[model samples]
Target: MKKIKPLFLLLILNTISYAQGCSDAGICSVGNSFSNEIQESKNGIELGSIFGKGEADVISISSYITYTRNFSERFSLSGKVTYSQASGEFGTRGQFGDAYAIGNYKFKKMTNKQWSSLFGFKFPFSSANLKINGYPIPLDYQASLGTFDAIVGITFNYKKWDFNSALQLPIINNNKNSYFKEYSGTDDFPSTNLFERKPDVLFRSNYTLKTTNQKFTFRPNLLFIYHLGEDSYKNIFGNRERISGSEGLTINGNLITSYSINSKSSIELSLATPFVVRTIRPDGLTRSITAGFTYKRSF
Candidate 1:
């Protein structure tokens, strides 16, 4: 294809639908994104793709289609949809992932520093229950989290640096998964049956370096994602059990480079890796490393 897209909105850390499947799912890359930008038109679209290695060396891939409508200099809205897949020891699976819609409002004041508020939501196509051989697969294998989540975030810019923070709250969890430890192939990755995920709070900081002509840009980013509480799942007895140690933080380091093909279009490459990790990630948001590309245009 000619292009691909980016977002929890990322594990936008794993880097939107992780920067297509990057962020926690698509949270970090919505609305007025946290990355460096050279806005050339009021309406725009992007195609992005992500390739990653997750737990147990599962090879994962995702693609996205994104559209943005800029109402003015201070406001904009964006919609992104994604499809994801993976191949591990078990088998290969692919499907549409989540959909996100976000609105952003930039503060009118603060000339030296621009402040923007972000709000959005995630809609899943599957219930985190992708199955094979009559059994539910691990989260890393499924394309969607099967949860409806609300997202709110803020972005602040000072010169070449941008700071962003976001919260993703699960308004409804419809995950009907049944991948238990018993289904494991002699390895104990946690059971995700009836997985009940907690809220996530994420922070990101990045610095942008651009050439004198502003045609090429380089960015280094750091992301921190914290699980608000321990996740839970129903056991065989139907008892809700908390997955201990599920409440913690994951840290990722990201690097990005972009090329401006013209005034109305551009191309970007992003890379991310986990520098710090949690012991147990049952939410299916785990990734060891990620790489992706985005082609953007303003019209």
Candidate 2:
């Protein structure tokens, strides 16, 4: 009983520390130290759902499948495909979402710490075809923006703590109908513009605690994100228009729990919510919950 006291206290504090930040990390940032959890797995598969509600009484739900493969001792590759649906005060939309690929390389290693860099690309796969009463809706309900994005990230791990940061930049312009094209009459709103891509920077840190028996683990995380600029677009009248107050900062807290089902598999539950918002975001998620399971087997 005496030996379990410290461990029990840590468990209690971890549960209260709370997780995931902004749209950038979502549930993926919760308790994901990356160094051991991902590198140790030869091949792994994960299926999960993300559900959130935010401004304008909007609710966003997405389902995703992620696969990871370790090609070498220090190199790994992963991919994710998602389907998302959203509805609420604005409108409703359902479609396949962006697909992304990630590659990681570990360049430094020590007895208890590791450092790695990751690069990835996100491919646009969904169409922005949301309508209301046969009229085009706003951009808030679309599942995808149809832009190709490149991501670069770095991660560091020490013991049970992890730190990671990533930058996401859109490399290709979205040319699809990602704009407000419908109004009562074309003459009334003839200058609607299509949004341009913007950049996102995200940072997250987390600590994990494992039960003495090692069957369960608890993790708490803090996250921050900054938007570099507001989205811009060309209006129907050929004028450049910028979405004001789009650039801002977000802070979030996250908590995650994982239970080992066996030596090769585990189930995870995660929660993420924003604690601060410092901008005019007309389209953003404020809170989300995720439940998923992961399975790993040697190849």
Candidate 3:
């Protein structure tokens, strides 16, 4: 349709505006418009897949299933579980990443503007200590971060624009990886043994466009993720050392297109790439480009 022209223009403009970002670790993907879709519906489910290339020439694939139930107009809850795999010349490793639960609440006092808050928790599957050929592989090859994380965010929507801010904080770290000791020097892996990650802060802005029929929707977003502190790792001597250059910011531009297949079903696609990056990304979250597909069903 003629309206599609603006969607492409928005995508181009979004990429140009950054001129410069993420490597995302599970923040921007949640709480779209504070999950208003799930809020409006009584119940829903989603299945999705995301394909990405990470550091050290590793390729990653993630599949997830989500279910949401609405308790009322002001509150809703959703739960998700994911399975992820990473493979490359180093080797292949696959496992469950984490289980996530998100709770969304809308503000009743905000009559003129839509404001919502989100809180969630991430439960890990196991210690991120996958081995290959008797040697420990780097974070890029592990499916899970091996940390229990707490996520809290707030969203604001006004007309055609949306804004969000969130934080992903590690509450408990059980990462037992020792890849650096075995592969850092010999295999040219980044030296991040026993990886301990810091919390991340996120800021996202987007503009949404829809066709007259509302069957088609396009959203272009710019996401910023900031590593809050210097990450630490255990060295050869068993002494903890700070990984300098680990604390920095990454910016990414993303575009999402969605189509409605009747009322209860829809398909969505998204593409994202970074414009700027930090010198180091030890959390195994770097992605040069990412593409994803998702299908949703409402009940």
Candidate 4:
């Protein structure tokens, strides 16, 4: 029994969701978000799934688990993992995504307002063997970027409203990708090459309204994402190819609700839709819905 324990734990970790990026699950940051109403929370866990549907019959399902620990009155740390599977007319794929560690600090406080800052790091700790029909998948479809990134942000809270802004930037290049390929004159060419990706900047805000009994609450949120630049691909011939229509802005709106089962647990549901798209996005998500259950225990 003891010898099997390590393998059993590894299997469980492999199945854990490694969710990343900003899809329909509100604004996904690198840490335990600082927008929670219960500021006194010492420990918490969140588990959820999100379903996304897009054009060309494309569909995505993602699962996630997050753990948070607060060591002091004004500081906290969080960790999360995700797994996802996506399918469309092209093909299907399932793999682990990314992992994150975040630290948050409350820097200022006032009568009805508070300010906080956050910084974190995301590790591309997943297997890079993701494929579709035995062929390498594109960056948009792959489960992991195979690179490390840094996350930084700030938050402002006033009354029942919370505003958050964050930046995600890749600090390293992925040179181990063997997926990029181009067609030659009459045959297909394959190469294990490097990939260059742009940074993502996001701004999100939400307003919450609760019932008198505080058992039911409703929240509406808006998220905006801006891609900084165009992504590049290096072919086997050492020539760089610019991927067109890859950089743009996306705006999404979400309607969220929560029902408290008790003080220690709650159930939440949400629906998100794209409000505005500034560029031609290929395989972009048009709508998504998410359901989550949360358990919180203060120590």
Candidate 5:
């Protein structure tokens, strides 16, 4: 156990280093909108619903409400709520929800510009309950986890075409440990008393291109997520050693089209897919597709 401590620390450090260097890393960003827990569309006052599907018998349903209000033309406040449910055949089913509030301050404003810079802090709160099958021998149990994250990011926007890029980082995170570990027969699960607080790092980029007549917009995005501390998972039924990790990565792509009718309201349709790039096997190789619509009434 003492020797394993060094190895575990090394893994955690490596994950953080890689997350910080994602821009230079060769990992290709997937192209798609609606693939993210947080919507990439940077607009004021939007509401939408999302439905996602994937191979391996997976399904997800979600709804979102977002509002952005500008202050003094250079500062803005944005908030969003996402409620989602995900279920898979490989002994996984759960419901998760996230709520975030961000403050944006524009540094440079360019008229008809192709690029701009905005800085902001994101406060993300998440909660989930998951269950695994073939566990505890014929009985299933619920496991829950919750987290609070403090994040910051900078965004670059283009005007001639609807395109944007962003990079975000989490400076602080508060996670619940009891929700992640399971009990063992001989060795009791570590008490939550020893849990430690840690931060996560994430990188994201998004771009939008409009076709002729501006009837359709193509949006693509990439996100790389890395957790910096140990998280534990157990198979109580198997009576084996628990699995623990401090790092993982996910890649996603999406395409969406918006059709305008009058002026105040438009209809949007989207398809999104996400893949786990690097992580523990079985739990890492997962994919999903989401199709949804947006209806807006301008005030």
Candidate 6:
């Protein structure tokens, strides 16, 4: 019985290390970029599932409150907090909570315009807690991974068609420390350092089509991720090892259909899938699917 606590903590740590980048529950940076166009009044919620290639599967739910205020004709700011949880078979379960604040400055903008450019920065802070029971013993642990990112992008809007391309660079990387503690008691156990702040770069492109009524929209996006620094990947199952570099290509297509219940209220549903590229396979090649909905209102 005394051994159960340590084992549980280890399981939690393991789940977080491998599952961080794979889950779809967190606030997607790209999604926030378009917040200005979304009718602002109430918050939104998205519930989805994450399917891994093998034994790893996750069901996730995320929600956010978006506020968009335009200070000038070309400047706007949006802030939101997103929470998500992932649970699967084999006693694998994890939760991620994130808060993001982003400011967008538009270079050129017109209603139903075909071209626009925006410079922005996204400061996202996140915390994760994981737990697994199937291990020889129960394991539970928590970690905080946070980073500040700068973004520059160009958007093209053609009637009902919208296209966006963007690049993101991490300006400040926050290294998080992981510690082990007894699951039941206030005892401190050996600590393990899981991840360090390393430079990260991301490129993404998206295309969206608006319905005739402009209430429904369909968006498909391609995201490419590259790690620019020598960051180490360690887990409860092994010793500290450094990953030379990492790259991932993900294609996510989401169908968001919105119904204007009234002038101030709307509901939306989104479905998305991420296909894995060989260059970015961490444990191995993987694939995932995410689907959810959101309810929004305008003040």
User: If scored against the real structure, what TM-score would every candidate get?
Assistant: 0.89, 0.80, 0.90, 0.78, 0.56, 0.61
What count of clashes does model 1 give?
A: 44
Clashing residue pairs found in predicted model 4: 17-81, 17-82, 17-83, 18-82, 18-83, 19-82
Q: Rank the candidates by TM-score, best first.
A: 3, 1, 2, 4, 6, 5
Model 5: lDDT of residue 226: 53
Give the per-residue lDDT digits (tens) of candidate 3, residues 1-299: 57667756666564433322243346767746274433356998999988877665678898889998888888888898888898988788888888889989987635446888999998888788877788788787777888888999998877678789999999999999887735345544566677889999999888888888999898878888888988989988899999888898888778888999988899998877676777777777776446789999888
Off by over 4 Å in 3: 1-24, 37-40, 109-112, 181-188
For TM-score, candidate 3 versus 4, the one ahead is: 3
Model 4 residue runs over 4 Å out of place are 1-32, 39-41, 127-129, 175-193, 278-299
Give the per-residue lDDT of model 1 (tens digit) for 255-297.
7778999888989987776767777777766766677899989
Candidate 2 lDDT, 1-299, residue by residue in tens = 36445544554454344222255222243223255554455887777776655444556777777787888778888888877787875457778877878888886578888888888887867545455666664445566666677888888889888899888878886635534434334221122245665788888887888888999877767778887887666666778787677788877666566788887777776655567665555334343332233443333
Give, for candidate 6, the lowest lDDT window spanning 10 residues.
134-143
Q: Report clashes for each candidate as comma-separated counts.
A: 44, 5, 6, 6, 6, 6
In terms of lDDT, the best-performing candidate is: 3
lDDT: worst 10-residue window of model 1: 1-10
Instruction: Quote the lDDT for 291 in model 4.
Output: 32
lDDT of 1: 0.77
Taking all chains together, the TM-score of candidate 2 against the true structure is 0.80
The true-versus-predicted C-alpha distance at residue 258 of model 3, in Å, is 0.5
CA deviation > 4 Å runs, candidate 2 = 1-21, 24-33, 38-41, 89-91, 175-192, 286-299
Lowest-sum lDDT 10-residue window in model 2? 183-192
